[model samples]
Target: MKKILIPIWLLGLAAGCQEAPVEASFAASETAVRFVGAGPAATRTVVEADGTEISVVWGSDDVIGIFGRGATAGNNYPYAAAPERNEPSQCTFASTDMDKIFKWNRGEQAFYAYYPYAEDADAEPNALPVVLPTQQMQNGPGSTEHLAGLGVMKAAPVTRVFSEEDPAPVGFTFRNLFAMVEIRLKMAPGTAVDVPVRRIRLLSEAAPLTIGAGTVDLTAPVADDPLDITDGKKEAVLVFGEQPVLNKTDYQSFWLMLAPGRHPEGTLALEVTAIDNSTCTTTLPAVAFKANCNYRQDAALSLDEFVPAEAFNATAAVTECRVGEPVVFALSGEAETVDFYSGEKFHQWEYADKDRLEYSDVFFSFRAQMQGGAQLHPLTVKVSTDFDGTFEEPNILTAAWTDVTTRFTLPTKPWTANNGPNTLERYLEEGRMISSGEVNLSAYYDEKSPYLYVAFFYHVDKYDATLKNSRPGIWFTDIMAVRAEGDTRIPILSQTKETVHIVNGDKYAEGEAGSDWQGTPYEYNGTTISPLRMWCVNNPPGDRDAYAVTNKLERKVSNFGPDKPESVKGGGNGDAPRLQLRVCGTGNLRNRTGGPEQDAHRRNGNGLPLYGDGKTLRS
Candidate 1:
């Protein structure tokens, strides 16, 4: 048996329009042709029709495609109510387009009509090319404009006999072609009640929302059976006009239109996306949607466990640099607030392992050997509190450097050579290592500066080929700086490649202490190597045993103990040494007991880790 679904609105067939019951109603007129209601009245008022409350009214620009009997095509004729019809009550419809007027002939004729008139939509009056749009717009509450976009309705055929002197009203038994869904959403028990909802999607694999472009066979027998939506989409989205906030006390209503079908249990769900781009889903029970019927679904949405992935990210240009040099950090992402842990004395992420209240003393240790030159003043240690990160010469010369060279012991003469002066290969071994006792650096620690720079000024006063004052080759190894509080030594710096920025400055002229080195470029085995101010790890250019520069500052044997250096290979491209400052070890830094890390990973909080450049350390 086929269920005859009635229309939810009515159009009065008489001049003095009045409300009628759900059953069929008819009226007759002498001059003008009118449409009567066979199902429900079309008005803006919330009227009970067929045991459902709906408000459907005739708009001012309504049009209908009407087909006369024995004709294959239909004419699109516009219809509207009277000029004074404004209230939510029954009204009559008359032709609005002057050129497309519909008249009856003196014979028995049957007429077929469909709402939402289109010009090219013509078939055998059975297979009308009806397309349901996927994206539906929302106007407001109780506004049928959203439903008007996807709603398709057709009237049952009506037969009448017309004469020149006598005219009668035509009644239509209109029926809807699709099903309706009304969703009522509320906040879950622990969810925030004020989060705004952006969109809601209805998903079901067994029951699709819409079919591809196809013809609707209006001549089908049954109206309640599942519509043929074999090739259709699995999801239908409903966008809200005003992103309404959720409340636990009341429910917000949203409407959607989809194909009429039966959705299997456990395959239907509603996903809601909030304004913050977080999503929440709730399952819907099994349901069978019939044509011309609206199903109301009530569900709760919880946003408590949804954490947006694009919250915050940070990356430093250079992870470790000299103290006076600037630290450039590039930050991105969106957040309500952000905190930057500088890893300085008191601003470290590991607060428990912060620097002591008052440092007892600051000192440095180094191993160096001076070879070739009679003058032992080629190397000096200096400290500055105002040097930027730029490696230019004028910037370095303008900065005030405090001479701290006298605080440490430097090598005075060349180590005992195993062979001649030009072939003294024993300097590359660990036996010639000269240890500089712990030198005080407490006077240069400025409390106002965020960083301090310690530079090793290695320069030759004059390059004399006669060996009178020629630049001596100097090698430094196992260099370290620390802060002492009683017996607790906190490492302030080390010589590692990643911790130092080395520049040879100019490789041409040398006279003043800060001038570019003018050491001659010598050819060695076809490669021209410049031996000027080279801060390299292996031997300097030309392989002269007296002036070959090398360093084992990056030796990995022990923290602060004298160990054999790595076997020295003779090349200028060998890895140079670097030093890092003020490293602290934290046992349980990211404590799960409290703070932002714990709060971010708390219950119902998605455990989103704070993303940053992994090169940065807390201490």
Candidate 2:
């Protein structure tokens, strides 16, 4: 994903070698050897020059190593061109001592020449030794001064008649023995604007160049064999004397000379270092270089964004939490972006491992009690995979619910003292508020859905409510669900009073149906009265009060108002509030009343029905 495409142009390295006009005649007194480039037929094209032709003229300090089959065979015949004459591609050369100029030998003479003269080379021109510099310095684009020591060029042998009849200088056309690469670097598309690039290094374990002294056989055909590099190098660093800001629209060219060969794929990596010392690297494609070829590699360097690892810090509030639990965390330091990891098997940091079919076991827990003569079981836990987020009764009734009530235990007898023995009172004295033990709810979990709706249906048939005993009110507390993973238990869905909400599920208006109230004994005695309900709070000391859904559900002695022994009110022990549910009417009290009538209960987190005013809940 971090890679970008770069176009490259490969062409032959062209150093215009042309023949000059022959002179009328040579003076007998002038015994100097004159030289000119080969004819136009051997000329190569230049890709980035002022014109279509590019010429390499001799420098003031330039010298060429020549070998003549006659007297110059045992010792090198160094030829120095005058500064004035060196301005042109064709020039006349003389020995270090002007008096000892090159002289014509007897018979048909044979001669050879090479430039960037190497002192370590043997006197024999057939096998000359040369070495290239590994460190290259560039002044600016199109500059070739650094190529003087790195570029190796050799001219073909020239055989001509040395008679007075011939006055024209013998010409030798030079051909580069190695390849040249013109790297035109520019900012990649979408890269940061104006990145001050300080340096770029080309690295390859394949040893792309032969930097050590090597022997080149001039006798053999140039293309017949490759250069014999005695010692090769794996990397080359190009240092820009002037630090330039990279531009996305234009490219800056830098040239390098390398021994020609096939560089394998993934063998070359370009490391670009910015002015701030940050660096990024990209691999180059495979390429085969040939002698005398100029590979103009246009690379769009990519440095999308750089962030140091030391600039980030994140701390979690707790080491572990249950599934669906609100895990708190504190983030510090800086970053361009951040992603959360749930620490689950499939939900890892890796992009590919984000989904799975397996899921952990879930459990539901709650405490319940029934008063009066509630003959029919009231609480039934049902699950729905698809539940639209709304309090509309039609929407809840239309949703498909799978009855999972058989999974948990339900109370079989009433707990009020008038109805039966005070079974709920005896349990409350022991601090065992959560009477119904945790029940496994894995059967309702659907991996395909993000949330599972669990609804507690508290309803009684109106036909069986003729006697006050038939309308027994049910109580529920500590209602919650959690995920079980080995020994660890993760909170799946839990809510407090602040998060619970109540909505109109029937024809009645919103606030009128689900309002909290204190029910009087007369209300419960009425045969046609609706179900009486109220909120109460009285949690025991040194308990998990925060985890309890409701503090208490049974009416205390303080709630009795000098009425029948069975009378109930909505006030807990003197200080805390209490709630009581009583049936007083003959109308149907079912959650779904067959037609459009439904219960008025709003849903909280994870699609669970709640019993508070319609408002956002705080878990």
Candidate 3:
């Protein structure tokens, strides 16, 4: 049968007067009464009425209290209190006073009732019972104190009036004042082992209720509400023995009777203490609970698996210059220069003769030969912000330069001729290479400056250095600064040939007996027949070579050996033929034989033998 559950707060009542003549009947609804317990069978009961035994399910313990009002009454009187079930389903009132009989239709009358009547056994005979405090109302039974166990206390009211002409069964609807809560433990999926549940408890802020006038003052402050009950003692906590397992299939379950209140804001905390385990305890936050409501909460606690973070692998594509085809730098003393001989060709500074060289502003690019594994290294490309057409005034290292490497997005392909322009593949087979794209320098370009000092360096960490030579070397090709406006290629560095004058056996030569190359000697040989005295240039004659013979040459053979020369023969007679060469104007002439300097000597300057003291051709 369906039974209506109700909630009520008992209060101090006025004295009840004698009941007038009234007739009434009561019957329960078809709704089954819900029992709050550890399980479903806690609410079973049997009711007897008029010598007939009826198996009726009471919501809680088998106890009932009824109060009635007559047709002309001053106050409601408690007329019947039945604490247990009779044999034949017949419930008889304790009071047999017939003066309070039912009268036909004088005024409306009703009955008020509550379950577990003995819970209020200390009440006065004709007066209402003293209302219990909210905390004391829903307390569990203590070992030393016999308090009410986990059960429901409801207040049912009947509003129907009875008469002989139209008899109506009075229906009562009960309302429980306390909320029912059931807690169960579970484990998360893939949890291989079970953890024992040592203890469980709720946590919340406390707000007590003051009992009066058939209602509760929910605004009262409590000294021992959920928030105040932190001792976790037997009176304040719901204790449980240590369970063997707390897993998905096997776990601990229990119920708790909490005081009725609106817990709308803060969460209802359930702290579960696991038995001697690595993960000792866990608290389930934000468990919601409402006043006078039934709650079934399942908490799942799982151990988080350990997973390591991923490592960073940085890669890049660099373009490199081929051997014998490097982007040569001009011999400008402004930039630091280092020369190493690799191939047959001498790779000297291109514009070493010029006093100053200017290069157009353009993009610079190269291939970076990264030797280390997949690791990100700092590659900085800085350009002089205020070059000011000079290399000395502002040192390139200390001068103001903006790093433009970050401005360009470099390609990340490994250096290979197949992926690069031109015949880079053949070069790769010979050596390692990195293909780098054009790094734009348009932002820092200045048209007025004679030359822009630029530098490229790699700041690699020493830990990531895995090459035989820890120091990495970068090669570059197509390394011209081109001005896009006019498609002009700046002359930063260019190869040039020059004829350098050399004297055989001269003190200024590489190995000589007496040479004043660094300083002028006080007394130098004006003329001599010593085989070393025969002047000769060291370079061989070729299509690219030119010689300017100002004074007529006297051909002679001179001994050339590490030991001293024995004698000198005239007109190409010794083992090595010797041609007497003369140094004319400006003995420090370039390597090229017939160039602008030779032309100038033939035009305006005197054709004097550079070796003699301006006296005779043979001198």
Candidate 4:
């Protein structure tokens, strides 16, 4: 229910009347009317015979001749209308109780008849008591959509009624949002009865707290919108009044856009208010309206989040792919932009003035031309934009790899596959390895990240960076990871779901730097990258470990070598370098141990393998 609470002066219900309830009670005995109470004298308050609400009113003198209390004299004691059942009329002293009481009825020139309270007379739907018939169409300027009576029969058929010989009140009801409200009005004869009210407002729906807390104001700017005002065919009708004028038919409208978590009511309200002639201010009723109201679904979107899928679909339709394709995930909402990316890389990668995976899916198919004995190769893909702030959220970087390792019938050759620019695939020719329907590629990257990540809406595709590089159409299969590149010194790293493969000290071009949280000094510990303890004391003081140089050119730590771990009673050395080294049978001057002979390396004892072609090295 909609309720309005304000100072009494605000309501025009009593217009110029100043009399209070108490004043109305004292003057009740002055008129011919008597205040009747229901119970004993002490507790009795005036009541209608039907037990409904009773007011100070003069009662019937119907039994005057039979009772003898001045029978003839009591018959016409005061100014009362003749009663219907041949009984004297009953009336409320309200007609004469206050000075303004009589003044208003005179000014309003209205004839009011007071009767005994009638029970069950409240607004019961079945009663159908004749109330004010209000629906009136003003034979407007344009054609009305309801002219043929196609939609509804509306309030009444005979547009307007005049009180020529008979008069009565009529009630009109209309739709305002989800509410149906009726208003009471009294129409008189020959008044023309067509008063065009300007503005009409209906009470808003009850505010919901979860959608918000208190009342929020939603301003629906009403202009001439065809869909709302007319049936999508008519121009909007402009109106100006404290009350809204019902179109030739039945419609006034309210439409608006609002923010998320916002609802409006109270001061920011809608309703038909009584307007003054000059200033045009008016009183707004708490219930119902003379004109418009509505609720619309799916009216707004938010941009506070990321870009939504609809936006990406409109923007990033994976036209091309090399190994695997990117799966589109929509984060559509009322957000200014909803963003959810699987490392949301560019589908069309361009590099060196050429485009890879252009006009293709995630994974593209390609044939490889391998040279003899070139088993290892580098697989690089070009991307457009980067959202991986140096690849933070990802533990690995991967690409959607097309299983390009599709080998044919047993080949006559037992050669290695090189991942050079020309070599796309390399593997053993004879065995089930070819029929496994999967590819175990040995691709190298110069970054600390996994190769590159790929996610596909479908199954695996054959990985062919060369195909994406050479062809114009390649589809993305799934996402694969590669370590991210940065100023990382660890290079030639090839990692998969299981182990991390690396070629010692791989290098990249001048600007090819990225990072992987699991690379170098840091390792993934479920949550964040933590420093590896082995790199804690990269260098040590003198006598920390005895290092020896060998003629085999293999540097071995004499102290922390095999014999030392054998004597100590521990599962394993906590900081031991789990690397194996061996010397050629015809040792090329292998030494017990050798590394960069810098003071820090010697003193700190952080030594690893070193080629004699160079001196000492930093591990």
Candidate 5:
């Protein structure tokens, strides 16, 4: 079962309007918390953050619950249940919201903030309903851990995401933290993004701005951490910190969130190296390129040690690609051999679709050939929702120009909720759903989750010719999976618009246990070749026109919710919609090469996982 939580603000075309400071004061004096973080041992030990020793747990390490806990019953039973509802709760390894605490950062003296994730992965096109904490928390120690009271403190807006290019007022102080510091924050296309960062100053002042308790201005020393980000148009990280400078050198990024207006007193004089004035130039790499050659992998994870030269590699999920431009993809590194095989675009389903769903019909086609004396595999491609009544497409190997411009038909059939057919919901172009008022699902892409493939599906209709195009025409590959390199991909479900897809939020790390380390496999089928079947039963293309379509996402059933039917909606409106789709057979993805873990494995084009005696990719 696949599990993902989509922050409402992180989804939709326009972000949930910049979060204004909540005025409802949550009295901190009324809060008290008995913190207990579980670990790898059976003994539930108490932690310093909470100052308690009730129960210490290990191995089953997990943030049990926050907010409140149930009390006991009998006076001496020692197992009494508390009565009092504590709605919404949080369990995170990122963000200053201690509720979302990950592994504690010993060095920084803060929570290992997992924050959100910028995503681009192989996931289903379904947004599970947002489930907030309703079960009353056990009123105990943790009731006081949160910065409750003072109402939701108004967050200081981004200081200077985008300022006059030249003579941008910048300065630097010192803090040895931050293993990686970036200058520019990349923004999704169209969406207005701003650049927000901490103030870096070398000079100290007597007077400083007091933003919040425990958090002061330059008046004293730097106390703020993690920099804030504005909308789009942020400075890019030209330098990833070559050497540890702070303890010895004179460099540091500001930590406080600066308010609008100009420089505050005592906080003027910015540094140059700390600011990145680099312009985004389309130099068209010295060599031809592929947009998304590096297949989608887990974010918050590392290939080799860190990641591929680039994290996500998808051509279909890009917003800045120039039409006819040569998009290049650099997956981990070196393919053993171009196997020219089969691939699974979809995976098994958790929730059944009774009331069929809808989606955009996208066609994929590519070819591999030698280039620059290196086994260069340039698989240029393009896509469109143009699903003409026609079915199978012709070979794209014989192209006139080397670019991603191959076109095909689209699914124009009228969208029927649950006509016993597998297909995608059309852009209704009306109110309530995909309408003229607010933006549709597509609008959220590129800008929100910049690099990701949005899949579409409808019910399986035997009578509809379009439904029987390939497999069970019900499901189809609408777009390839992808997301911005910086954002972490998260799955979400929306009923207001009847839409679902992956969204890019912040950055994250995949669990070492859940990493795709076994690698992948591939094989030969007569003249037709393909990859090892991980998610589907393989059926060689009977001909260039025959292929199988499968949902490759590892979906989670628990995500459907309690009201969901015991069985997935197989043929009704209450059931979840399903898609029947296949991959284009013109590429080497079919017969993929072998991996250290048997099946074809993906290598880090950028080599990480820290080679030599490594355990999984975690090695």
Candidate 6:
């Protein structure tokens, strides 16, 4: 629920005059008294600076008489008669004594007035209703200070003098001698429940101002009055009991009149009694009640939604799973394979496999299964940092290569015939069949060599023996990276074709390398194929069984220098290597030869020494 409290000022007239008199009468030319405010109705309106409508009860019973200077107990002349009870809007005053008609001389004059005139004209004739500073007025007969009801005083001094030559009637605007307070209660929006309020009360310690001829002193100090009416009243308490709150937008308004001074500096306690004999109390911050100013306080009640306590289970809430739940995925249809280290483009390492390095201590984890229950093949992971863009002179691979196969590990168990039907359930039962590994390339990381490359080496002998010239499925799923923190795992590859796709091996051919080779076209599958996927041929087909290996795995490069020590780098702590690379794939050999692999024992296009024995090239 939203609650807003805004204070708005009511403009009171300092001086004003009635419309031009139809008859030639001095009384009609006299200034008329009025109040103006922002309320929709005239009676509810108070004085505001920009208001135009006259107060409905200006000269009615609500506001009885007006007295000018020198009009005291000893002299009753120069005063107006009681406001016409029948026509409250009437502004012109009437006097019975013709010799002492109320007249405005050619000079300034001041006046004071009170509401609910005194009935007894003899006892304290000029004493307006007054109360003790700490006494609370209740709505009852004993609360009255005099025959007049609750008193509200206002004093207005007309500074502009009136003259016979002036054609307009003079005007005098009055300002309140007491402070007006209004309390508003509302329900929060979207609240469907109802809160029945039996009663609402506002309690404050207050006292009256000193009223004198043409002046009202609101700042006067309060004095103890033991002789004052002492029934059961203690402090000023305005009680509004049994109000209905029907809907979210329902609201209730209550107004009170208090002495023209700041109340005691303390919370104004508001007690709300519910229909069930229960009560809720809320306090508002201390406020100052300045004379002639309107103070509005708004409160909004919000109801909390109901929730059953019995539905919570303490045991299950704190339980933690030690073993990771297995995720299963499938790969179907043709798998595209691209050669990484062959042609001029491959020597330049211009492919989608290159990426900017962003994490330290990167770990690659996945569950892989070879189709037809074939034994898992050995895989090699390597990293490099010196390969730049020049392919004409220094071959890309000759720059540097670090074999990181020892960083990888095989699963605990191997695949068995008896497994569950679903992918997840089957993988869990045959979890040992999956192979996972980590590559810590922190040593290759440096600001001078901003880019790091990664590659995978599949044994040519194993590919030729198991599946060659055929798309034998090799399923990989749940391929993710663990950064510096063992717990922080970011997904790098997914089994779904849409998330992971093959880099067609033929696309690595010399002239075939286009803009698509530089991390663009492959992005349509949702993930960018890094430029590092350039393929390399270890030995020509004539010398040995040709096998293709994945190449050019580059980490995300940084334009800024290496991260500062003790400062956060990328998404991990800067103390360790901050970069990760993950590659997942399926299917068998789509062998390539020719272009740069014709001469054996010679430096190939990648500038790597070629040997007849597969072991020399593999190492």
TM-score of every candidate: 0.42, 0.43, 0.29, 0.15, 0.13, 0.31
How do the residues 229-256 of candidate 3 rate in per-residue lDDT, one tens digit apiece? 2122111234443233566564344445
* Residue range 1-619, candidate 4, lDDT tens digits: 2222231212111111111111111111222222211111111112121111112212332111000011111111112222224322222222221222221111112111112222222322112122111122213322121111111101110111122222222111111111112121111223332333432222234321111111111112211110111111101122232344322223333222111112233322333322211111123323211111112111111112111111111112122222222222211111111111111132111111233221101221112222222112222222211223232113113322232323322122212332212111112223312122222222321123323322111111123343321111111111222222233322222223222211111121223221111223222333221110000011111111110000110111112111111111111112221112222111011111242222111011122221221111111
lDDT of 2 by residue, 1-619 (tens): 2756574555543432223333333322245556655433222212234322234555557776666675323345677654344335455556665533556665655567777666667646666886666667776655655665566777666655566766667666566677667776778777657777655677787765646767776655545234677877766777666666787888877777777767788887776667654566777877776666556677776666432222223333443333454534343332222333333333232222233344566677766556556444355666776766454557667777788777777676666554211233433443323367787756665555545666655443332324434334455544566766667777655433432223233433334323232132122122211122311112111111001111111111112121111212211111211222221111111111022122234332334332211111010
- Which of 3 and 4 is ahead in lDDT? 3
C-alpha positional error of residue 369 in candidate 2 after TM-score superposition, expressed in Å: 99
Tens-digit per-residue lDDT, 1-619, candidate 5: 1112111111111111112221221111112211212111111111112212111112122221111111311110011112113311111111224433222111211111010111221121111011111111112222211111110111121112222222321111112111111111122223232322111221112221111212111112222232222221111111221221221111122111121122234332222121121122211101110110101111110111211111111111122232223223222221212111112121111111232222332222211111111111111222222222122222111212122222322322323343211111222122212111211233222322222222221111122233232322112221223221123443232111122222111111222111011222222232111111011111212211112212221211112221121121111111112211222211112211122232222222232111111011100
Which ranges in model 6 have alpha carbons more than 4 Å from their true place?
1-63, 68-90, 95-111, 121-127, 131-151, 158-170, 188-192, 205-236, 239-242, 263-266, 302-619
lDDT of 3 at 148: 32
Which lDDT values do the candidates have, in the order given? Answer: 0.50, 0.50, 0.32, 0.19, 0.19, 0.35
Error of 3 at 161 (Å): 4.1
Give the better candidate number (1 or 3) by lDDT: 1
Model 2: residue 138 alpha-carbon error in angstroms? 0.8
Higher-lDDT candidate of 1 and 5: 1
Q: Estimate the lDDT of model 1.
A: 0.50
lDDT string, candidate 1, 231-329, tens digits: 677678776565567776666767776777778777877777677656676667777666665566766655564445343333444433443344444
Name the weakest run of 10 consecutive residues (lDDT summed) in model 5. Answer: 289-298
Error of 3 at 507 (Å): 99
Give the Å shift of residue 334 in candidate 6.
85
Per residue, candidate 6 scores C-alpha lDDT tens digits across 393-491 of 224345566777676664333234642122334434544345665555556665565355444433222234343412222334444443353455544
